[model samples]
Target: MLPRVLAIAGSDSGGGAGIQADIKTITLLGAYAATAVTAITVQNSLGVAAVHLVPPDIVAAQVRAVLTDIGADAVKIGMLGHDATIDAVADALADFAGPVVLDPVMVAKGGAFLLAPEAVGLLSARLLPMAAVVTPNVPELEALAGTQVEDEADLLLAAQELLESGARAVLAKGGHLPGDGDEVVDWLASHEGNRRFASPRMATRHTHGTGCTLASAVAAGLAKGLPLERAVAEARAYVAGALAHAPGLGAGHGPLGHGWTLASG
Candidate 1:
């Protein structure tokens, strides 16, 4: 049977992020993809213009409908728009036995808030505890860890502290690190130890859904029974390839080449 990975997130009307990105990444990684959209955004590669949130109960209902019936081997979570939505997700997944990868999507690439400020506290206290792995970009990391992760030491320290908050592990992405280097480094911190993954950063503006794609790819790997470290490594490599081969679209930042793996095969 193909690994089943479910994405519970918002809808990116542009097909570059959120549920669209999750579906593309999961399917390309050889996993069955299912989704429960928590919100819908009028967005494209350029940026978000408006967002309409689905009711919390409705979100819970969607999650329950999928988890109890079709079921999921692993879950990728992103952009729960409100506090109630966060609670709804937490309530619905309380008994999930499979791995959960949470992408704490706070801000969008064009500087829009995907998550409410009040909802951030609820998510940190509730959902973070439930996640098997939490993927956060540098700014998101600083927000969660309450300290700037500017260097390797800061990266490990903040990640370790955040992991202790309840998540089994945290992937602190270093893609936004400065110096215009050709490579990007990500630090994975867990109870066991820390792992560093380095890859050449493809210089492109088509990195719209990288965080969502990476999390979903890791979810697919976990659904296939790959270990956590291996899953993250595979996700990083996959994202790099996607970046390298992005099919430039829209007037602004284009979407990654999510279909590359499928085309290669």
Candidate 2:
């Protein structure tokens, strides 16, 4: 039987991030993909222009429909845009006994805010506690932890704070840390222990859907029964491969080659 991963996120018109990226990453990783779209984004590789949120009840219904029917082994959540939607998702997932990978998608690559500021608190209160692992980039980590992250030590501290807050594990990404180094390090911290995964930063402007891709990849791994550390390691490798094989579409940040494995084989 194929592993099933339910992706709850927004729709990206440009197909670079959000539900589109999640589906692509999940399907490519050999997991069945399902989605409950929370918003519709007018966006391209350049930036997000506008957003239209889906009704909260509709989002909840979509989740319930999938959960009660096709089912899921894991869930990957991203870009819930509104407080009501967060509440809806929390309620819908109340009894879903599967691992969840939460990607706190706050800002688009073009500097547009994807998540409403008021909804942040609600998400932290409702969703963070349920996540098996929360993936937060530097800025999102700072916002969630309510602190500044100037160094790797700060990154670990903030991740620890999140673990204390509710998350079973936190993948604190240090790609945006102030440094001139050629490598990016992401820290995966859980109550059990901590480990670092580092990849040499590839020089490219085509990393549009990286966060979504990584979270979905991790969810796929979890759905396939890999442990957290192994799942994260594989996800990082997959994202690195995608980045290296970016399609270079559009003028600004371009989309990654999520279908790289197809071509590689």
Candidate 3:
């Protein structure tokens, strides 16, 4: 049977991120893809112009319909437009037995807000409890932890604060950290301890959906029964390959070649 990964996210008109990226990443990784769209955006590689939110009940219904039938081996949650959507999504996944990966998508790359500030607290309260892993970049990590993460030291401290939110693990991505170094490091904080995954930075602007791709790739790995550490490792490697093979499409941040993994590595 094919591993199923249900991605709960917004729809990107540009197909660079959100449901589009999730489905592409999951499918390229040899997993089945499902989605519960929370919003629709008039967005492209350049920026997001407008957003139209879907009803919370409707989003929940999609979740119920997919999970109750096809069944997901793992769930990757991306954007929740507001508190209502967060609550609805949480309620829908209340009884799901699979691992859940939460990507706290607060804003789009083009400076558009996807998650309302008020809803952050609701997500921390309602959804964090059920998530096996929460993936946040430097900005989202700072927002969720309510502190300045200047370096790994500050990030570890802030990640400690998020651990109180009931999530089993938090992967604090350091992609935006200020440094002239040629490499980036991501920290994973869990009950066991902290581990670092570092990679040489690739000079490229085709990283519009890097976060979405990474989260979905991790979900795909989890859906295939890979352990957390191994999943993260594979996801990082996969994203690196995608970045390396980025097609450089679009005027702004270009979309990655998600099919790169399927090509000869």
Best by TM-score: 2
Q: Count backbone clashes in candidate 3.
A: 0
TM-score against truth, every candidate: 0.98, 0.99, 0.98
| Candidate 2 residue-wise lDDT, 5-78, digit = tens | 99999999999899999999999999999999999999998799999999999999999999999999999999
Which ranges of candidate 2 are over 4 A from the true structure? none
Candidate 1's residue-wise lDDT over 24-81, tens digit each? 9999999999889999999998899999999999999999999888999999999998
State each candidate's clash count: 0, 0, 0
Models ranked on lDDT:
2, 3, 1
lDDT winner among the candidates?
Answer: 2
lDDT for residue 144 in candidate 1, whole number 0-100: 83
**Candidate 1 backbone collisions, by pair:** none
Q: Rank the candidates by TM-score, best first.
A: 2, 3, 1
Candidate 2 residue 240 Cα shift, in angstroms, is: 0.3
lDDT of each: 0.91, 0.95, 0.92
Alpha-carbon shift of residue 160 in model 3 (angstroms)? 2.2
